[model samples]
Target: MDESYYKYHLFFCVNTRSDGGPCCGDSSAPQLRDYAKQRIGELGDAIPGNVRVNTAGCMNRCAEGPVLVIYPEAVWYRYQNRADIDEIITEHLCNGRPVSRLRI
Candidate 1:
């Protein structure tokens, strides 16, 4: 099969629910997603391929809130702050090792 365009594709669930239910948006998924995107851009060639970070609608794991999935490995994680995001980038994105503590 042809190689994937990006070595890693991160999809952050930024869906917002108006029914007073838990959602990724309510957990600052968008802001966190933006931060991850910026961090990836800053890494440049340190990571393989063109790492793409995208916003996704309701990954159906709202109960997990602020969830993100990294493709090529399909590792899923739940993050709460910049530190969590940084760890994922540093340990997973840049180093090819998934952050076990944050994995969901």
Candidate 2:
């Protein structure tokens, strides 16, 4: 099989609903997404292949706001804070192991 374009492509949903509704942006997805990007930048070559963290519009999983999806594997995860972001980076992105507890 061919290698993935980016070993891990992370898409963080940062959409905020017009009316009152649960949304990733309202749940701090942007901030956490930035944090994840910074952390990955710091990791540099320590991580395999190229990892791209991007901001995405609504994934329609509003009830599960603050959601992030990793490509190639298409693993979805819901995170609360920086610590959870750290866990994802360390375990999944770095170690090639998905964090079962965070899977959504």
**Winner by lDDT:** 2
User: What lDDT does candidate 1 reach at residue 102?
Assistant: 89
As for model 1, its CA RMSD to the true structure in angstroms is 1.0
Per-prediction CA RMSD (Å): 1.0, 1.3
What is the alpha-carbon lDDT of model 2 when measured against the actual structure?
0.92
lDDT of model 2 at position 84: 96
TM-score of 2: 0.95
Off by over 4 Å in 1: none
**What lDDT score is found at residue 77 in candidate 2?**
97
**Using Cα atoms with residue i matched to residue i, what is each candidate's TM-score against the true structure?**
0.95, 0.95
Candidate 2 local lDDT, residue 16: 90
User: How would you encode candidate 1's per-residue C-alpha lDDT over 31-102 as one tens digit per residue?
Assistant: 898999888889898876789998899999889878999998999999999999999999998889999998
Clashing pairs in 2: none
